[model samples]
Structure formats: structure tokens, C-alpha cells
Target: MQRLSENPNTLLALYRISQAASSANTPRDAYIVIIEELQRLYDPHAAAICLINPNTSLLEIDYALGYPPNLPELAIHPGKGISGRAAFNGEPILCNDVETDPRYVKLIEGVRSKIAAPMIAGGQIIGALNVDRDHVDGFTEDDLDNLVHIANEASRVLQSVWRKRQLVMQSSQLNALIEVGQSIVSKFEIQSLWQTVTEAAHQLTGAGLCTLQLYESKEKKVSLQTVFPENLEFLDMVGDIAVTESLAGSAIRTKRQVEFSNITTPDYRDLHDVPHDSEVTSCLSTPMIYEGKVIGIINVFTRERHRFANSERRLLQAFASLAAVAAQNAELYSRVFNSEERLRKSERLTTLGLLSAEIAHEIRNPLTVIKLLFSSLDLQYPESDPRNKDKQVIREKIDHLEEIVSKVLSFGKAPEGIFTHWDIDDLIADTCLLVRHKMGQLKIDLRHHASSRKARVNGNKGQLQQVLLNLIINATDAMPKGGILTITTKVEQIERRSVVALYIEDTGSGIPENLVARIFDSFLTGKAEGTGLGLSIVKRILRSHHGDISVTDTSEHGTTMRIELPFVR
Candidate 1:
């Protein structure tokens, strides 16, 4: 220890090496600097830094100086050679007589003596620093001591650099995650959502190709849904994998990440679901878990044969979570829209029944008057006359008409509604939630303005919800691009009657002038796919509740629908 401190030149060399390693931006750069410094100070024929590869736990040369071209290709197992022995023991070795040492594994010819010292960081042996000479017994105890000090200093700087880089990379990954999450939420269509996730995984992992597979519990299989680049030619060759087979299947089964170091080998040839291409080498599969169940699998492939790091595994899993969220949101979107459609159909049927009943009652009174007049005008005629047969036919048809009217009246009778006092603002807010995702996906903004005074309405909750949904859906359709949807509620006096006025407005292309007058007329629609019953049913519901709806404003800028219902205190 005294000898190490006494040499001014040795101290200067160590200081320079430490500075070089510290100034490097990456671990690879620091490795090069440390190896070059070792060559300059010791003047050895060859100097190299061989670190333990996390994947193989072997001493593999990371940086070297003055070694053969093939030196980089060699990986020595721990406790096998001088450097390996140093790393294995976590100590320094001064092998002056190579011929006498049984542990030495010959690599470069004519190299007789070598010195190895383990590079320990955080109380663990990471690798070893090695310097070789061409003659036997060429290195001394003092040389070995200097080498050990240099190795320790290099290890400290290297570890600091590694940690800094890791932190920076992790920060980048986190920001990417935030962006990807936002993108995932904005994609309502399942295919677009799957494509977004696939591309994100590919970009984040830097993989050659990324594939997204969705798990179908009913089918008990995982099918390839989408792929990054969208141009991978081997898609036709890939097949659906059962939950019990393949790398992706294993991930789903275990709910854990599964890795294959090399998929080109004969053992993996039977994995029909994995893309078999020469350019593709390694594969990593992670399951997308949602609500404690596996929803799908995300598989990433690397072009070069490589072992994935712990950080990479964590990132892939994070992406899996994002993918799961996208899947969940898409499913929810489908369900909401489907439910809205079903409700619309139900409301249509109810309104149609009420209309039929009203028409039937109007015809029933006149038919009874006709029947009474005909009975009063009873006339007798000869049995052979055609007029007698005609009278009989008229009587028969009249009776048949009366019977048909009575049946229609019975079938069209309105069912008693479940009416209650409900806050208009709360109902509107709740209804908005159902279409919020759709609005977001279309880039539409929604603004709701609740009345300062409580605007309560006495009506069927389901009917009112149906009304709001109908108007909102129509507004969304009118805006094919994207715009703002505004909902406002206020209490006002109309013709001395207290009423609640609800306004649903959209910044969309307004209703055409030709259709404005009869927008509420059944089967009158401007839209290509419109059933034309939405607004008609809306009008019927409002009328039944003694309310009214009108187009208060319309232009190319937007449209406003005002629904006025009698206010209940």
C-alpha cells in the first residue's frame, strides 16, 4: 500500500485513467478509454477488458488493444483462464510463469506471462482486466499491485457511467410510455389500436419486427392481429397458436415473459406461429394482462442473436399493459355504441305503437257512426237481383273493417311508463360519459353548462336518456370531421308556463334548408344511412311528456336543438 502511494508516476497514471473513464458518455466508450490507458501505462503487448456477459455469465472481451482480430469472438467461462479465475475469485492474479500454471488457457500464441485483476462494483465481480507479455516471468509484484488499483478505479467509473446511462434511458422510456398511452386512448377502432401498439412496441424495443396477437378465450387460441411495418411478407405463413403451445402461448399460459434466444435453430422450427425468416433471430413474448386475465400477447423479434436485458423485459411488459388498456377501451366503445343502438330501436318501437294507437282511436268513432247509419237504412230487394248480393258484400266488409280497427286499438295501447323526477344536468352528464371515448377518437370537444337553478323534469328516465343519446348521435354524424358539442340546460317561462329548456348544439355542417321544416317528420332524412326515425321518435317522446322540440338555430356553422319540457319543482 505504501509502495502504491509513494510512486508519483503511478499516481499520475491512475488519475489520468480515472479522468478518461469518467469523461466518457457511455459504458462502451469508457471501456475503450480504460483499455487504451492500460496499454499506454504498462506497455504490455496486449491489454483487454473482459466483462461478464449477463446473458451467459462468461468473461467476454468488451474492449481490447493489440490483440488478434479473433480475440473479440472468444468468451471464457468463469474460473477457466487467468482473467476468468480473477473474476471468479474477485481477486488479482500475477501469473509470471504461464508454462507452470495449470489454469491458463492459451489464446494468442507466444504470450507467456499475464496479470489479471477483477473489476468489482457494488460488491460484485463484473469482469476482469488483463495485460499479457511475450516472455516468461516478465511481470512483477509491483506491476500486479498497480494493475489492481487501475482495475478498481476503472470499475468505479464504469459503474457510474452505466447507472447514468440507465437512468437517462429509463426516463426516455417513461416519456414514450406517456405518449403511447395517450395514443392508445385516442384509438377507438380495434385494428387501429392494435396497429398503434404494434408500432410503439417496435419503436421502443428497436426490434426488427413486432407482432400483436390477441387471445380469444372462447377459441382457446391466440391469433396474429397486426404487425409493425405492415409489410412483413411472411404473415400468410404464420398460424394461430393454441394457448398451450408456442412461445407466445407459453407467455399467456404462465402470464410471464418468455424469451427465445434464437428461433432459427432446429428446436424452434416447429413453432409455426413464429415468423420463420433468416433475418429474424431472437424473440421475446410478453402477455397483456387486464383485470387479472391475460388479454393478448406482444411478440418482438431482433435481427441479431442477442439476449434481452432486464430493463428491456420491463419495458415490453409496460407496453403490454398499454396494449391491454387499448383493447379494453375498444371493447367498451363497441359495447356502448351497440347498447345505444339497441335502446334507439326500443324507443322507435314504443313511439310507433303510440302513433298507431292514436290513429286507430280517430277512425273508430267515424266507423261506429257509419255502422249505425247503414243499419238504420235497411232495404229489402228481390233474391235474384245483383244489388241484393252487393248489399250483403258491403255489410260483410264493414264488419271486417270494424274488427281490424278494434284489434289495432288494443295492440297499440301505450304501456304505463316508469316516470320519476330527475335532474336534467345529471342525466346529461351521465349520457355524455357513454360517448366520451367516441368523441375523443374523433377529436371532438364537449362542453356542458348546467343551469344555476335546479332544472328538474318529471319523465321516464330511460326515455329521456334515449332522447339525449339520439340528439348526441345525430350531432356526431353531422360532424364528419371534428368539432365542439355543447349541452346547456336552463329553466325558463314559456307562455306563462315554467319549463326546462335543454339545448344540444354542435359545430357541424347545419341541417339542409330543404329538410329543416320536416326534420321531425318520420322517414325524412338527409343522411345516407339515416333510418330517419331518431328525431321523429325524439319528438314523440317529448310530446308524450307535454314537451316540444324545435330547431332553434341552423346554418353551415352549426345546429342547435332546443327541447322544452314542463319544469317540475
Candidate 2:
């Protein structure tokens, strides 16, 4: 230390080296100056600075001065060369004889001496700065002291630059996270949001591939939600990495980020059956947590083994948080949309009910007066008189009008039925009785068949009656030209459970092919004066009973509607 301050020329050089080190924005720049100062002060023929490459676990010459252009860049393991020894021991070494010193590994063959000092900061030897001289006994103890001082200054500068770089990188990553967060929030559609998230993750990590795996907690399995490149062959390779088998799976199970630097190693390689062409050397997988449980994983893949810096991990974690929020929001939005649609349908049904009640009310009073007049005229005449035949014709016409009016009144009236252990066969009979008048008017032959097994289903006596009645009425309407109307009841077994089926078939003009799909939709009518609610109301009643009504067959010949109900235990 005293020799370093004794020489005026060496002192000035030390001062200049300190100034250059202080002004350097990075450790590499400061290291270059320190090596140059060592050459100027000691007159070395060759100088080089080697630093550790953490990824490969090898020392590499990051910056070198005064070495031949054709000379291979220095690369050595820890504790391998004279410089590696200084780096390994964290001390300064001045070897006076190149051939005699065990620490020296000759790079340029000649009789020479060498001085090497560790570039250490925070108690870790990052690498070493070394200078070589062609003359023997060229470097002195004083020169070693000055070189150590300059190496210390260089180490300090490098540490500062490294810290500054970390802060800058962190700032950039944070800005990217903010941008991704904003993008996810702005996208309301789930598919669009997923696309944005995948794209953002790829951009942030500079990864060759990005994938999101969505887990169905109830199913205890995950599915690939989205994969970038759409056709990337690595999907099968990386996608096969199970949540129970690989590092990604471990992260998902732990609800944290799992990083693998050396994917080619036996430990990690054994976990997945990756293909050679996948070339996935490094991986960072973060869990997507929602409601305090890991719901999925977001994985990023790089082409080369990477020591995922802390900043990169943090940025990815932030992005994962945003993805979770977006997923939850998208699910909620879908639910809200579905609820709103149900409310609208309910409102429309209520409006239709009210309008039907009003129309029935207006038509009932006038029809009652006509029925009273017809009855009086029939009483004033005798059945055997010559004029009775003409009077009978008038009476029959009045009765038909009354029957039509009664049907309209029944449609508007609230259902009423005495619940009983009634056979579905009997119910079909009652429904046929109601529609028998219309069937006669249309000249349609109505055939009814019942299951010999006596199948019974639990339901509202009156509502079920109404359902059958509406279906029969619609069936008759379909056959305006008087085709056969077939009503059949049978017991069926579905999924190893017994069910009762009621089928109604008509031979009238079948529903148009285009309108057939929506025939059961409310307010969808094919007739000029049809209310269009018959099939819709039938469907509603069947659904309320935990049953289903559907069109089983339709063609130009006819349409067949079937209703299925769970068998009563």
C-alpha cells in the first residue's frame, strides 16, 4: 500500500484510473481502463479481463486489451488459470516465472511474468484482471499494490453499474406490466383478452413460446386455453408436461413460479418427454391464482438456458396476477349477459300473458249473448216441425261458436286440477276430448294409443292437461285439410331409468323446414291469426316438471312432437 503512493508517475496514473473508473457507466468500461492503466504503469505486453458467465458456469473474457486479434477469447473454469486462481482465492498474485508458478496457465508462449488481481465486490469474486510481460521479474510488489487498488475501484464501479442496470430493467419490466394490465382490463371479450395476454407475455419475456393452461378445479385437470404460433410443434412437447409431473406442474401445485435453467439436465429432462426440435433450454412457469387457489399456469419458453433474473420473475408474476383478474372478469361478464337475456324473455312472456287475457276478456261477453239467443230460438221451435231443421242448423252454428269461445277462455284462465294418481292414458283422453270438437270440424280422424304398462308420471293435474290440450290443438291446426291426428303414450327407458313419453303426430301440412327449428319459440307463428304460444307454453310446462318436449320427426307428410317425463318413483 505504501509503494502505491511512493511513485509520482504511478500515483498520477492511479489518479487517472480512479477518474476513469468513476466516470464509467458500466463495470466492463471501468475494467478496460484498469487493464490499460496496468499496462501503462508496468509496461505489460498483453492484458485481458475475464468475467464469470453464470449461465454456463465458465469464466469468459468480456473485455480485453493488448491481446492478439487472432488469439482465442479466454475461457476457463473456476480455479483453473493464474487469473482463475486469483478469482477463486479472491487475492492478488504476481508470478515472477511463468514456467515455475503452478497457478499460471500460459496463453502466449514466452519467458514472461504476470500479475493478476481478483475483481471482487460484495465478497464474491466476479472474475480477474490480468497483465502479462515478456521480460522476467518485470512486475514488482509495489505494482501489485497499485493494481489491487485500481481493481478495487473497478469492482466498485462495476457494482454500481450492475445495480443501476437492475433498477433500469426493473423499471422497464414494471412499465410493461402496467401496459399489460391496462390491455387486459380494456378487453371485455374473453377470446380477445386471451389473445392479448398471450401476445403480451411473449413480448415481455422475448420467449419463443407462450401458453396458458386452464384448470378445471372440479375436474382436477387442466386444458390448454391458448397457444401462440397456433401450429407450434412444441405444444405437444411442453403441453404434455403435466401438473403432477414437471416443473410447470410443481409451480401449479405450489401456486408459485417454477424456473428451470438447464432443461437438458437429467433431473428436468426426466420430468418431460420433450422432443429434440423443441429446443426449450430455459423455462419460467407462473401459476394463475384466483380466490386464493391456483386455477392455471402461464409458461414461457426460451431457446437458450437462461438464469431468469429476479426482475424477469417479478414481471411475469405481475402479469399472471392480471391474467387471473381478467379470467374472473370474463366469466362474470358471461354470467351477467346470460342473466339479462333471461330477464328479457321473462318480461316478454309476462307481456304476452297480459295481452292474451285482455283479448279473451273482450271476446267472451259478445259470444255469451249470441249463445243465449240461440238457446231461446231452439226452445221456441220443436225438433219435429218442418222449420226445425233450419233452426237446428242455426243452433249448431251457435254451439260451434260457443265451443271456440270456451277454448279461448280456458287458454286465458289459470290452471286448476285435482291431483290424483291418474294414468297418462286418461290424461291424453281428456286432452283429446277438449280438441275433439276441432278435429271433427276439420274432418280429421284422431287416433289415440296408450301404453299397456300403466305408466304414471307426477305432475300438476290441470297443467299437464293444459300441456296436452295445447299440443293437440296445435297438431289439429297443422292439418287444416283434415289429416290423421295420432296421439300415443309409451314408457321408455333412458340411461337405465324409466321415463314416460307422450307423442302427438299430425298429417296436416307439416311445418315449413325453415320455421320448424323455431316452432317452439314464443311469439313465432306460421298462421295468420295464430297466437304462436301453444308450443312455447307446452315446452314451459314440461320443463317445469323436469321433463323435455321436442319435435321428434317432421316432413311434408306431417310433424310429430314428443314429451318425455321422468317416471314417478
Candidate that scores best on TM-score: 1
lDDT for each candidate structure: 0.85, 0.75
Q: Give the Cα RMSD of candidate 2.
A: 19.5
Off by over 4 Å in 1: 175-183, 218-220, 227-242, 246-250, 258-283, 301-307, 336-379, 399-430, 441-443, 447-462, 474-536, 542-569
Q: lDDT of candidate 1 vs native?
A: 0.85
Candidate 2 lDDT tens digits, 85-110: 88888889998888888777766656
Best by lDDT: 1
Clashing pairs in model 1?
none
TM-scores for the candidates: 0.78, 0.64
